[model samples]
Target: MLTLCLAVSAHAASPDEPLFNLPLEGVHAFYPGDDPAFASVAFDDGDWPTLLVPGKWSESGVSVSTYVGWYRIRFVAPDDLPAGKLALELGLISWGDETYFNGELIGGEGFFSRTSPQLRSYAPSIYRAYPIPVGLLKPGQENVIAVRVGRHFNEGGFVGGPVQITDREPALERAEQNRNQAAAVQWVLFGIDIAALIFIGAAYFGGVRGALFWSFCAMWATHFAFIFTNSQLTYELGLQSLMVSWVGILLLGVSLYLFYDFYTRALGWGRFFPMTVLATLCALIPPIVFVVRWADWPHSLSFALDLAFQATTTSTMLWSFFCAVVAWRGGVRHAWPLAMSGLVLVVAWMAVALFASTDAVLQWGGIGVEVGAKLILLGAGVSLGIHFLDQSKRLARARESVLSAQTEERGRIARDIHDNAGQSLAAINLKLQSLQAKQARGDTVDAGDLEDALSFASVASRDLRDMSHDLAPAMTADEPLEVLLRDHAQRLGEITGTQIDVVSDGPPELGPQAKDHVYRIIQEALRNAVSHGNADRIEIVLSRQGGGLKVSIQDNGSGFDEDAAMQSDGFGLTSIRERTDLVSGRVTIEAKSGEGSVVEVFVPVG
Candidate 1:
């Protein structure tokens, strides 16, 4: 007969109530069935050697084999041993073990001994449980517990556990609570991982070109796989599976790589090839470790490699934090959310490493941190999604603005050709025709007339040059936005014969696209002030305010109804509004029948 004693809970004792505790190191062992007197209360032979309970004889450096050793404990109860329906719990055991309490057989895990040569070893994952009836324990009395173990490998016998005596009810309740908590966390993590996968899949398949999103999904997916690998159900199946551990090891490696890879991409640092190599190494470690492990590698080597893998994981997390900090410092606002999530997960890992890494029951740390990890990851994903969404919206707006600017540019080019270049060419043609007529009639050609022809040609060339510069200002490439604005103002001033003042206060950095839009808006405003209002003097102001750029162009000219201008906006003013709106900016126009007009624009820096 084989029986297992199962304890339902890990914490049944209160702070003030101490239970009867026994040390395993003081146990005595003997050859099983060597003598029936071994079970007698006073029949301990002086020659019997000591053996530690809750451990193996081989691990204790003793020369022993299967079907030969017996573990016995002689312990005296304290005055406070609980008086109730007490239960005994011996956590997971392997190979074979038979339990004897006070010279009576209570439980066993396998069939063994001289009377029965049959051996039935259960899977290492299964816990052997037996019920201890009430009134079976004596208080304030010496008690003996003996276990006869039969197994040869490290996976056999009582490897890591405690033989505990606990009150049945509280322990059972606690066990149920743990199961419920674990189930809840597991379901939550599964749901989140699935949802994340779906979301990332949608984004990836929807033409998101970046590698960041899918790699991010892989990271989460691999973690999800890792969770099940540590599940007891998986562990049990793995006992009979050749590929379970291998698959798990491979997934573990991939997960690690994806984690680090996603972090690298999200940080958007330079494309460091060596980081990928390092990530590959991280990805390769688990499979290699598992292969070597299956090949009977040295235990210490396996331990060292496993520790290295764990260290790398922690190091990657730390490096991620560092990268996030660096990114934030470099003005990547998206990094803030990553840093926060990383901090939480890092602390969770630290707590898990400190307290729960070696635990067999729940190998993924405690439930609290497990739940915390899920929540942190979920929140991080949401935050990242929002960030990308905002960036996408901005990009779309910028694209629209650029397209509008292109259209306006084409129209301006056509206008310049017709108004300046074409007219000059036509006048030069007229002058040449007149010269040809004078030569045909033998009339004298005037030097003044030649100079006038030369002057018209020069004006055409000047117009072409100015139009080219306006179309694509070389200064726009590297000059500060204020410089570009000043140049535009100077050019407009020359044409209008009006004094134009450009003043810059705290000129904020702006990208080329934004600068183009701003310049065009100001140009439109200046054109209106001159052509429509007939402005004498103009003032342009550029400044930064609240992490944004502000532009104001004012002119002292005859003004018209502001509402009418907005209602029946000319092409130039409409283009100005479109450009401003595309950049998610605000624009205002103030004008009256007599007062000067002011056009003001505000655009965000983000």
Candidate 2:
């Protein structure tokens, strides 16, 4: 059990009453130097102005104009003091501080050098309890205590609760409990940031490398740094990196700008220039703010820079909401979810700012920040999932279409073979049987019968060859496209008894798939000219036109109406159009009744 004493009453404790409060009404302050004699009990600090203990120098009814300051407190100890190791509990000190009891050094934290005050500690709100030596206090007599504090920026001095002296064990235990309670929220937030990092890193490296995912990942990483830097654990562990928090703040603006950029693109709009300008301002402002505070400039300038930073950050959030509404109005999918998430973030942050003056809200362990991040995560995750699902559906539909086309083509080839070659072979088989019967019966066989049999055999061979050509020509990969086209034209001319001419003017450097599509388009066109248009002569030209491959097929046939040909249920022109589209090529057909017809195709080359 530890005896308690309060510093607010200024009363010395008696043995019968171990618990009493003492007020620090005699605390005095001096400015601008770190003289070693200031801590001595014999030094005269009575001429210095009185200052309020457990309060900031700015609020202590005194003007402090330098980075180093000192405070002295005089207290009387009871003659029958409690026999135990004691400690001086200074609730909190800003920046850095050191304390002395009865002209002797007790304990202190942070660098107190007046020449290099920038290297001082900055855990301004942490409870500090330093152990007091056993023989330091004089019974029934005045004891002097001195404190020196070094300020880097912002308010300085004892800025927490009242100071007191108590048993070392219980004082330290209470400090530990307070520190833990104050830092509990920061630990939880840090854990949330870690989990977010894992999930985003896994998603990015796992191939979800979209603009949204990467931007969100970067934003979360910056947020993590901000939270970690501000966390009490980082200070408790003595890991302070200068200007790291500012860097996080700077990157936050860039991340928000990137989100807006990606959002506008999703809505089919180009980059928004105002957002770009705002992001540039965000990147530029933080460094200025950091430098102003670091050099300990005028408080007015520092306040202005701080205000600018807040304004920019707040403007970014508001701009994001505006973009979301724009996207929603444009009918972009998942925009409403994102808007709702942003709404939650805006409301939470507003609450944080609104209740900043009250300890009740500040002590919630930053639930607002955590909840805002979680909501954004939910929105981004849902959006990504929906995008992936849509991509999968499109891919599946394309696969199904390709498979259906392949099946339809195979059936077309089977029917052609069965109808043309099958009948021709049957006629040839019957004619051979008749010739064999005549020879076996010893009857006079006529030359006409042999001639008829030979003709039927020729017809069957021609039909089989045409069917083979329709399936695919026997050509090597290295064969020139013009050679294939000319060969195909010659074969068609032999069957149709028409004059076919093929001319190549320029190189058509195309891939294998593109070449196949071109060949099919030409085949379809040639068949249409002969079978449908009853053409007698056909002319084909291959050339390069305007950085693309051009193929033109013309025939002096009794041409049919172009619109009617395209609209008819026949597969000739329809197949031509389909093949052209497959290769990302364009085709135009020109025809008139009793006039010549032309089919021209243009395909781009890499």
Candidate 3:
């Protein structure tokens, strides 16, 4: 018989206790190679060196010869142990491990048959629990347990633990609860990704569409896939699961880069090709990493690949932080959240890289990879939502502005009809009535009276025709914009007796819609000059300069306060600004009291 001494302090057994936590007092390990005889009960490990339990072999005080190691531990069962099937529960084991109870093969993962030792079979970040046979333990007697571990990466052997022996029923119940908790967390994350994807997709397809929105959708979609592959559903896939997860992560990086690319552009920072280059690298690196890892590439090569993966991901995060800060400093809307999110990601990465050896730092700080990831998602979602809402609000205000302008124009048209056409018709009717009265009294009517009636009728017809023309300009679609503007300026000048000059020099070939807006802008400016400014001279210039079309309307009218006009609910200058914005152009108004006003518009062409 081989007797192993465990320096566990004696404690009285209690039947009511749910389980027993086997003390880590006397665990022995042998390094470098594996032997089937090492699992036999008669084999003596007395000469082997002692090691720390509930810890990795690499970190334990003893040195490990190779990637393979064997650990032997002895524990005594309680005298009052329940009369039921028992179980041995160990938390996560890095890479792989095989367990034997009293020389009988019981359970394992990654590490398989004594000769095979399949290291690729590892299941990461999962709890380990194996059922013990009914007669495997003798009450109040010592029991020996042996474990074979194969190290693939990081720290090997039992890297995670609360190693214990317990009743099979209780252990199963606890395992189920733990699994449910883990699964719940995974499902929650998956649901968040789904919700974000749906929102972004709808925004992209439903009118607020842009490159920025599309990239957000893609990022969330990739994250959803990553969550799926990393979840329990893919645990049986072993190494392939990790590969798929990595691929998803890499693709997510690509999406993030694209997102910032468009985001910066929207903020008026222009596009940076380096961002595109990083995105391309992220897109191309995944396949190579996947293939090499799947082919079981040399450890050093694999390490290099891992290093590259980390490098790209970290670089992407740093770049995101840089962009966010720059945007915020530049007074970009919806930028603060992005900056906060980037900071969180950087902090999380630092914590994982520097303090991953222990859980204490993450727990105490209440921030880790999981927390940081969720924060980032929250920040992004909030940012997108705010932008959408802002756009919708602006759109609503623009619609109201347009409706107000239409109503005011209709009022002006009504006033013109009543003042000009109505009065002329009334005068003709009065003259005819006077002619009938003179004929009734036997006095002949003068031919000059008939001529006066004809003149009044002609005036009415002209005013009506002018109103019709104002409703819709009589011009073909192919007509140049300058021709239409000059006709409008001439007509307005003929009516108001103002000297109007329209100088055109290489006017831009804007689309029909843009031309309409430009025409309306000039018309409003002219009307404002005639009515508000009471100016007698106006000059309109159309020219091409600096890759843009410049429309300058200068009037020697009684100009009002530009600031006050912009601040008020007036329609003329406001309409000009809104129309310019619709076509992605800029408008500037220079005016002072009793001097002159200059309204200049710049619209990018080509």
Candidate 4:
């Protein structure tokens, strides 16, 4: 049985060890070769696969291009070993890794460019194992260990220690703690991704540049979901392991494409679209290579793919930078959040990519990968939060604008009534008082003159009532708008001495604004007909046609030219046109000399 015990000091291979002294040709020789005493696995290699010990691939004569491959090492536990826990320590895997001890699955880790190292630390919950349990071993025999490693572009892997055996509980505890921490980090990443989706969805639904934002967000969510599932933080739906691992990278490419679209539109970088398309296409290259024959591709090709990945990431960063600069230059206050959030994301991604490429720090059970992923995720969260806040502010501004407009409209109505209708009413009251005084003093008064005065007074009263109704209509509840039209026509006939007829055929129920605007437009049209057109008979028709409301007002009187009327500097036509425009409606005027005019307005309510 393999027994693991704690040593007072860190375990190191003896300098005299034969494996260390072997004049291993090339970097591969230094690595535990297929020989059981050293290493026993040979992964499919293409394009210069590196054979390096637990250190920087660069030092092992392996360029960054030679990062992905299968690694195997062989070791034999002594037959006399105590039956207890045993442990194997690895430094860090670049993007992600899977390890098997003596054909028994040990653990795996995966990384995300958008997530932070801290978040990555907690990601893999299921794949993490405390220590290579002695129970997993066939006692005192040769054991084969294999590792399948994948990396991001420009990042190469396996930068720490090789296989080591120990029974130390402290070491085992530390390993377990790391695995637990990684699992936690993964959960956090998942949470942040979920939050991003919700925020973007809300932004889109709220009419805040939703299409572009949601497209980018959807792609990101898909990519992260693949990473989470593949990394064993969550259960994977059935698929080959290699396919599962590479799927996220493929998704990342797609996300970057959408992100480019969003960023370009946001920043007004129209010229970048071609480049964005190119980058998206370039992203497909790696997946294609992997699909064609993942085993046959040299490490260099994989490295090149990693470089492309980095390039894509860098392009996204550049796009973000451009947006920040544009916003800053434009003096848009809201741009700062986007700029800062983007900066954080870029910086976080760079830090992880750099850490993954170097062994400046010790790797004890995939801690580095965890740290990098967490940092990226934290940055993503910050960026997403900023986006949400900006959207909220924009909505607030739009609502305020609407409210301000409404307030100004009410004020204008008040002033119009105060200046015109109010003064007229006061004059009528004075005339009435004078007539009453004359009658009370027994002064001679003509009955006809008194009747004329009373008629004038009645006209003033009717005008005042019409003005009041115009300011605040009695029907606040939704009713068929035809009711309001009929009421208006009746009032117009009583006041103008002109025969007014309102005809309706299947009029649709209108929203408040639509109803209000139509009423005001008709009121204005009637006023113009009486004061300007000198028309005796007016016909108002309200009907629905082609999913819209059509209002027509025709007058039988001597008509003026349309151009002359428009140049007369009157508010009636202008006001009607403006109201119709507010609801994206259209207006047409048909009039000529000696013929009555027809004003046709089509208002879309939907």
- TM-score: which candidate is best? 3
Which rank order by lDDT, best down to worst? 3, 2, 1, 4
Cα lDDT of all candidates, in order? 0.64, 0.66, 0.67, 0.56
Runs of candidate 2 with Cα error greater than 4 angstroms are 1-72, 92-125, 137-141, 144-162, 243-271, 325-330, 348-355, 361-606
Which sections of candidate 3 miss by over 4 Å?
A: 1-27, 30-51, 57-84, 95-124, 133-156, 164-166, 197-207, 236-268, 279-287, 360-368, 403-576, 583-606
Error of 3 at 258 (Å): 4.9
What is the Cα-based TM-score of model 1?
A: 0.51
Clashing pairs in 1: 3-108, 4-128, 4-129, 4-130, 5-130
lDDT of 4 by residue, 470-564 (tens): 67752474656777777767876776799988898887777787787788788878877777778999998988764568899999977778877
lDDT of 4 at 396: 56
lDDT for each residue of candidate 2 in 1-606, tens digit (9 for 90 to 100)? 001212211122111322433445345566546677888899998678767776666566434445567888888887887777777888767657778898887877655243334332335545678788888878899999888876533356776654887777766665665565555545655666667677776776666654455556656666566556556666567565555545644555555555454454333343456766775676677667666656756645655665666566566666776777787787656576667777777677666555543333333314555557567656655665565455445545545566656776787677776788777777778987888998899988899988887887788788887777666743335677898888888888887798999988876578787888888888878878897889999999998764468899999999998788866645367667666766545688998889979999987554
Overall local distance difference test of candidate 4: 0.56
Best candidate per lDDT, number?
3
Candidate RMSDs in order: 13.7, 12.8, 10.6, 13.6
Separately for all candidates shown, the number of backbone clashes (residues 3 or more apart, or on different chains) is 5, 6, 0, 49
lDDT of 4 at 1: 6
Displacement of the residue 164 alpha carbon in candidate 2, Å: 1.6
Which regions of candidate 4 are displaced past 4 Å? 1-53, 63-80, 83-85, 89-158, 168-172, 198-213, 216-220, 230-232, 235-240, 271-274, 292-295, 352-355, 360-606
